[model samples]
Target: MGTTSNSSLRSAGSITDVAGIEVGHFTDTRRPTGCSVVIVRDAAVAGVDVRGAAPGTRETDLLSPTNLVDRVHAVLLAGGSAWGLDAAGGVMRWLEAQGVGMEVGLAKLPLVPAAVLFDLFLGDSTIRPDAAAGYAACEAASVHAPAQGCVGAGAGAAIGKVFGIDRAMKGGIGTASVTVDGVTVGALVACNALGDVIDPDTGRVIAGSRTPDGKSLFDTRRSLLRGEAPKPLITGTNTTIGVVATDAVITKAQATRVATMSHDGLARSINPVHTMSDGDTMFALGTGKSGKTLGMMTLGTMAAEVTAMAVVRAIRAARGVTAGGLYLPAVSDL
Candidate 1:
């Protein structure tokens, strides 16, 4: 396994701060579609939590504690609706090419669990993420903090779609890490929600649906409560996906608990999440390199804290965009 440099990476407070982990992105220039990869070349114990009713996922069942496969090579978050799940194949292929994977007779099958968000509506829907794009993301893998904001799977991400996309704001990728007693826990999130992105610290809407004039933030939760914006739900059209990694050793079941608790961060950051229309998914990876000890309660709480921080970073780092008479603004614009 190749080791990555944390000397500079830690300064950026990125997920790469977790030892032996690398992050990469591949954004399609022709359209706002791409994939992000978290390469754990040495493999790590992994767990996942699918909290939404409509999810576009791959290999989540294998992450169960009872399952035989516990070591994971990489995790992929992408944009393209269900079709985007195909990109995971490319990740697996790349790992196999590098002689990485579980030995199965003469072949080594890489275990790559993935999740996808809906960005197909952002550009030409015909052009979605493919195998080549995933491979490119692998090629771009770096131990340094990756370029966040409007890139990778978050390039075309939109949030606060309670009134559909016309009033939605730009959503993107962000990362943050926290160190506790020598154990480091980090998070990377691609935010594309059906509700507003709020700053949990202040309880203010950050990047979210704008008013009809598209000038000010329209708190989605408030709108729904006041019966202002009510529309039929569009299943499988929205999602927020991310990964939380730690250097502490943990069992697969413990990792699953970490992932589940991370949702507290999502709930705090987003006004309304895990709706029938949203496919919110979270993954937790334990690299077990720190040789540090922490109780499950402490670890899970820190997971949620970092996850929320990353969500705020995604909106703050995001850049606005305008296309086809639709204007999606970032937090800066608000």
Candidate 2:
């Protein structure tokens, strides 16, 4: 990647910093589960990687390089596990109303791919994201920088579940951007992990499992060193879903590679990530606005780097939430 000053990177702001993208979220704070949508005002070449063993995804197969649909109109990340997939319907409706989609003989089909994280247990599972919520988010879509932490799909997100819900910390959405040689890459993450959250720059646990009394730190990596199984007071309730976008022109295959590489950020920040119980997934989008100022390899590398930054930012920006009789601490508490 071409050299970019730290100040420039810091000033790049959220994923919307990439031209032609609009983001919005519809949250039900009372239920603590919601949905987020990234509306590509201009359709973008997209690719995805689903690393977690139990992922709840929609239309991901169509994103393959060999597939017919090379560009996507929107990508959604939401809470409520598989049930949240319904939110995509609302996105489709919104796009269709705007007359943005693939042309068929009589009508247009909006291409929207979505991923869902398990947040049902965090609040009232009965109240989950639906088509109404999705449409609401789209109506609220704007190029304005997105709000991070404890918002959108991450409203009920939590991390460091290796010890259990009681010890887990709160996690939410975060965004970061870096511009190199005119090419801008940005990332947005909803971090609800099965492992501890570490600040990659500091190599320290910033927010994660804590002692029962909530006075001391608990490192999940150390527990794994002993090769012991963890008995989570709550199980099968975590995932980290995110999007990485760039203005550089790149092919769908290259975007797929970028998506694969972006997972490095998750590995760096989340210990024991992509676990069987988690549904970790990422999407890469190339808007082709800046030509090819950055090489594919360099762009992919920066995608990973910014992804890590976004992860730390998510933890730092997150605020704690108490639901279902459990208290999840935020990074500020640490």
Which predicted model would earn the best lDDT? 1
**TM-score of candidate 1 versus the correct structure, residues matched by position:** 0.95
Give a tens-digit lDDT track for model 2, residues 45-87.
Answer: 9999999988889999998999888999999999988899999
lDDT string for model 1 (137-255, tens) is: 99999889888899999998999898878888899999988877778889999999988898887998887888888888878888888888456767888899999999999999999
Backbone clash pairs in model 2 (N, Cα, C under 3 Å; residues 3+ apart or in different chains), count: 0
- List runs of model 1 lying over 4 Å from the truth: 1-12
TM-scores of the candidates in the order shown: 0.95, 0.95
- Model 1 scores worst on lDDT over the 10 consecutive residues at 1-10
**Root-mean-square deviation per candidate:** 3.5, 2.1
Residue 209 shift from truth in candidate 2, angstroms: 1.0
